[model samples]
Target: MRTHKYRTTDVAVDGGTLHAGVWEPVETIEGAEVPTALLIHGITASHLAWPFVVAQLPDHRVIAPDLRGRGGSHAVAGRSSMRAHAADMQALLDACGAESAAVVGHSMGAFVAVVLADTAPDRVTRLVLVDGGLPFDVPAMPDLEPEEVVNAILGPTAERLSKRFADVEEYLAFWRAHPAFQESWSREVEQYFAYDLVPVGSSLRPATSLETTIEDMLDLNTGSTLTDALARVAGPHAVRDAGQPSVLFYTVPRGLQNEVPGLYPPGYVEGLLAQHPVLEHHRFEELNHYSVVMTERGAAVLGGPLREAITERPAAVG
Candidate 1:
């Protein structure tokens, strides 16, 4: 049985309108301000990817938006950069009347979360980075071409943007065969895939724009804003109030596929954790890149740590 409810709202951003999916609890506290959490989806995803996580957070209001070029916000014009995404987030928060929020981002959304915190630290109170936030060790691969890097990193996800399906069911068939879903399929996955389809001519295509996908992917690897944010979040600088803000990162052992390793390169995350005391990491051996947050079990497991972060204050970093 469905127990949660979500609302769709639009806000005027710098370039165009931004569409958001906001989930509210079944019951509310009397007169008290509801704490909001900004849930950011991956590059090729929308707010629908978070139904399971939203289900887990009954007390806190979850505000999720289609970041510029996907879902209901796919038509939003202008540039789609991390900084632009961050500014849109600020506008969404303002529209929601939330002065601050616990920022939760998945995949590329995690990248935007870090940028949001770095660009506007005051707006963010705590962070939960699910399989993203830090740079993905692109520096280590000096020999690979830029396109090769994106292809290597994104793989089938990037390829699916151009493919057309006869119907949403056809799209579901494609995903059912995917290794990630073969073992752990659910209604949440179906809803997420159905929302991914947008009508194009007589057929249906993914709501995500191919140009937006490649542009964002390239920027994530080369963008100065992301690395700058990471440096601020990681390094002790004059910019921040305390040291690093409390961070809890959940990652998977395998990549989107069987042979590929998870997004973060080998030994990369450990080095980053070593430098930043406030950044705590958890590695899920049984889950893959997609299953880490997509599956129900993943969300239930992720929820325990996530709930603690929501209520618990950041331990002071020395």
Candidate 2:
């Protein structure tokens, strides 16, 4: 196993301090420049989500941040939107002195990555979107409230945000019972869940704010920011430019609960790729949404593609 140094830093952004996790390469040449890769986590997750992925990337400097409404930045005062998250990323890059980086995002972070690439194309060298970034084919319903929509999409994951646990172990117990993590559970996974707890009087609640999650969930699914951003990068002219970043998208076969037709179903993905043509698609057969970036096996499978994206030059796709 390759070991790396890890530390947390608070970066100043538009709203308030944003907490980020930085992992340095175990060995570095005296005068050579080390490449940087930015990893962004999901809606209700923290920077801890990248530990397994970071282990797979021993040759690069890895930085992962708790999005505005999640993890240690739960108290960051602002409405959680794709643009807001992208702005925070821009500030994080500046603070770390990383002029350009290979950007990788999972879940909602992928949406933010798309927005960042659109808003600041010069800062992104390439994009690797893990199980997100593209729009989902959700059924249109005009009568549904935002919370109802979130509940329908996220199911028990969103429900857990409202419930309180007796302690950290209690929270761990809850996650242990989840179908997604039963086979992939490890000490790293335990640490990831443990770090998610904060005291709520006598009990502990997940640090992610329910209101913020609902706002972000609804925005990403229904808002125009992602739609507009995707149009700019997925368009023909953008893909024809060798100077523009290339995009790689990975999808899983199962979802949060080990159910088939994961976030991006097979048919949906085929149609999406057919439409965009710019996105290169890869599928992980056995992994689900959570394990794709959080488990050792999943990280091992993803390491090669990530390394290629970080070191290879951008090429025209269409």
* TM-score for each model: 0.91, 0.96
In angstroms, what RMSD does candidate 1 have relative to the true structure? 2.8
The residue-level lDDT of candidate 2 at 294 comes to 94
Tens digits of per-residue lDDT, candidate 2, 1-318, equal 566899999999877899999999989889998888899999899999999999887878999999997788888997889999999999999999999888999988999999998898888887889998998656775688888888887889999999999988889999999999989999999999999988889999999978998889878877588878888877554565545446899999998788988889988998988777688899989999999999999998888888877778843222
lDDT of 1 by residue, 1-318 (tens): 453678889999987899999887777879976778889999889998888888788888899999898998888888688998999999999998888899999999998998898788888888778888876654455577655666677778778888899998899999999887898789888998998889999999899877887678778876488877877765544233554446778787777774456776558888877766557788776777777778888888888888878766642211
For model 1, what is the alpha-carbon lDDT of residue 80?
81
Pairs of residues clashing in candidate 2: none
Report model 2's TM-score to 2 decimal places.
0.96
Local distance difference test values of all predictions, in order: 0.81, 0.87
Best by TM-score: 2
- Cα lDDT, model 2, residue 168: 89
Backbone clash count, each prediction separately: 0, 0
List where candidate 1 sits over 4 angstroms from the true fold: 1-3, 137-147, 236-245, 258-260, 314-318
